[model samples]
Target: MISSTQVVTLARRPRGPLRAGDLAITDQALPPLRPGDVLVRNTWLSVDPSIRIRLAETTPDGYLPPFALGEPLAGLALGVVVDSRSPEFAVGQHVSHLCGFREHAVVRADGATLGGYGGLSVVDTLDHPPQWFLGPLGSSGLTAYAGVHAVLDVKHTDTVWVSAAAGAVGGLVAQLSRLRGATVVGSAGSPAKVEYLRERLGLDAAFDHRRSPLTDRLAETVPAGITAYFDSVGGDHLEAALDAMNPGGRVAVCGAIAAYDAETPPPGPRNLFQLVSKSITVQGYRAGSYNDLLPAMQREIGEHLAQGRMHYEETVFDGLESAPAALAAMLEGLTTGKTLVRLDENRS
Candidate 1:
């Protein structure tokens, strides 16, 4: 009998820091394999800004249901198959998706292929860390691709601005915009992150959001005004972007990390009127809403990763016991890109 450790939800409402009491780690015995199911030993657990939203109560029309207290806390993950009863996924297949936070999982054979979609092929590690599956080559990459290419419709003449530009999605957006021949600028909270963007990510320009007035720096950085804004921080960032957008500009709302842990999110864009006067378009998007676009996204991002056109960053915690600290660090902007927990040490 394989003993597995899993993170289970324990709170009905999470108002501030997600405490140890909010999640319980427990052991469970594996059940007998059922037909068409495959057993996977998880290696990585993704800790994302979206997980905070998933934990909160929302309207019935919400894209996903709120995580139930006392149930396994589910999120995106990367794993390897240890056993299989299905022909599709044999033993040792590497996989990544929205699996619960556990050392092992019994996923449907189709689940291994991501809802049985043939276009999404699971590749074995290619000299890259398994954690990349949760970042650049995975959901974060797709989010950046869809927002810049589809929603914003960036062109060679455009000037792009990305908030939280050193993050997984924002960094990818900065790279994609540069690829499209657009001038790219980004805003980061620290001097280190700003340096990472300018020196490492090769952004056209990067500003320290905490030290500089965003609107003034934006006006100086792009005298012609921003034609596309990949918004990840929201609040003041959103207002500043709105104030600097040129006519016919497009804003792709990817995430609002600045407001995720707040007891109350600051009011929405104060400069929304700019959208009307400048004839700008603002659209909110979720990567899960664009599964049909995954094939093309995967192919494009894969090519970039293979050719060194893009780079991925991650802050990894060593064990399930470090989950809370990992999540807290991510929220505090102590991480450069994706944040995840490594369960290899605790695997059965």
Candidate 2:
């Protein structure tokens, strides 16, 4: 068993964009285990856009509290129990929890509250890599599943548009929508990502959002107006979606990466009246609110994986020290699929 571990903590609240000095890595001794405690050796950590909100000095009301300066930052992680003092968890068992940005974690056998996903649960990766729990088979997958299946209710005849189509959640949204028989259109930042959406994910059409005006590009691809829109990038993308939405269209607002680290509030869609004119329905949700759907989503995604109908990509950083860069890359749109920090390099 390890006697000490390294963890990443916020050195200071970021101003505007995050900087290297804003995060610090330090080592400390493990606390002595209590009667109900379990010690875990973390193997994988997830880097997500939501963490950017925590780096601020204060978050909006009803949002998660900002990360305290000089304390360890947290997110989703997969680990193995190395030592246990409780009967609920045993050594060698694999589990998923919210103790990431660290090499080791000590938590109670009853599990800990992690934002909205509920208590930690034993995760059996089966024959797949344990890191899969941090990406396509994990929270990211669940988020996309909820957006496509529950929020939008995409149908075979519907035409769907997804912004940030190459991203972890948005990529799955595109694929799942296509699987449901919808005509899917997507937008990404670059040519490579555009190709990935078209050739790899099999979207009906995709274009580089940077190559032309988003409205023009979306209009070109979806001339008939979209029946369902899965939005990951807000600002102009949302505005464009509003302009191209069919009457009675449904939109699932997933994330707004464009405003995540902006110093000033981004302007809201200029065509706000479109919602009134078209009777559009727009709903925003967090992945945590749909925990009840995980089992069904898991079974469906697993079948897609087995049949080669679904594919996922991940940009992995080597160690805990690389986590800050990984987060920055994800926020800057430099990553594809899921961005992950792999702590246990020897495992795969």
Candidate 3:
């Protein structure tokens, strides 16, 4: 059994974009397991935008509390139980936990819930690659599923637009919308990502948001107006989506990555009045709040994967030491698909 583990901690609150000293890697001795605890060797760590919200000292209402300085940062992870004192979990069992950004974790069996956002549960790697649990079959996939199906109510006849469509959740959202028979348009930061959405993911149309004004590009791509909007990048994208939304349209506000690290708050959608003019329904949600949909999401997404009807991409950063860099790259929109840190490359 391992006696020590390396962990990444929040050295300090980031002011804008994360800096070199913001995150620190430290070695710590593992604590003795309690009666209900299981020791896990973490293999994969998911790098997500939500972690940035938790890094701030004070967050807006409804946001999770900040990560304590000098304490290990938490996210999602896939691990194998190395030792266990709990009957519910046994040694060699694979599990998911919110103890990522670390090489090992001591998790309480009772405290862990199965297969949803922020919940811990035993996972079966036979169905898919273990890392898939961190992306497609995990929180990102669940968020896309719930946002599109439950929140937005996308229909076969609907026309959909997704911002950050090349990203983890947004990518899944775009594909799922298409599977639902919606005509999907997507926006990405680069030409390559736009091409990825168009050629690889088979989005109906995609544009590079950096090349032109979003409103103009959206107008050209979705001239008839969109029936549903899955928003990840806010600010200009939100304003553009609002401008191009059809009457009675629905919007799932998933993330505001554009303003996540901004020192000053970005302006709200300038077309706020359009919400009333067009009678649009805009709702913001966190994936964790919709854990009730996990079972259905798992069944559907799993089937899609098994049938080769769906595809996902990942940008991997090897080792726990690369986690902060991977996170920074994700926030900068430098990564495509799901960004992850692999602690044990030998596994998968």
* Separate clash counts for every candidate: 0, 0, 0
- What alpha-carbon RMSD in Å does predicted model 1 have with respect to the real structure? 3.1
Could you estimate the TM-score for every candidate?
0.87, 0.95, 0.94
Model 1 accuracy (lDDT, Cα)? 0.77
Report the alpha-carbon TM-score of model 2 versus the true structure. 0.95
Local distance difference test values of all predictions, in order? 0.77, 0.86, 0.87
Model 2 over residues 175-272: C-alpha lDDT tens digits? 99999999999888889999999999999999998976788887788789898889877898889899999999999987777787777658989998
For model 2, the stretches where C-alpha displacement exceeds 4 angstroms are 345-348
Winner on TM-score (2 vs 3): 2
Q: Candidate 2 at 3: error in angstroms? A: 4.0
Candidate 2, pairs of clashing residues: none
Residue range 1-348, candidate 3, lDDT tens digits: 678889999988898998657899999788998898889899989999878877887766766677899989888899998899998888888899888889989877777442335655898766688898889888999899999889998899999999899999999999999999999998888989999999889999999999768889988888898888998878988888888888999889988887878766688987899999999888998787788888788889888878977778999999888888998888888999999998873632
Give the TM-score comparing model 3 with the true structure, all chains together. 0.94
Q: Could you tell me how far off, in angstroms, the CA of residue 87 lies in candidate 1 after the best superposition?
A: 3.7
lDDT winner, 1 or 2: 2
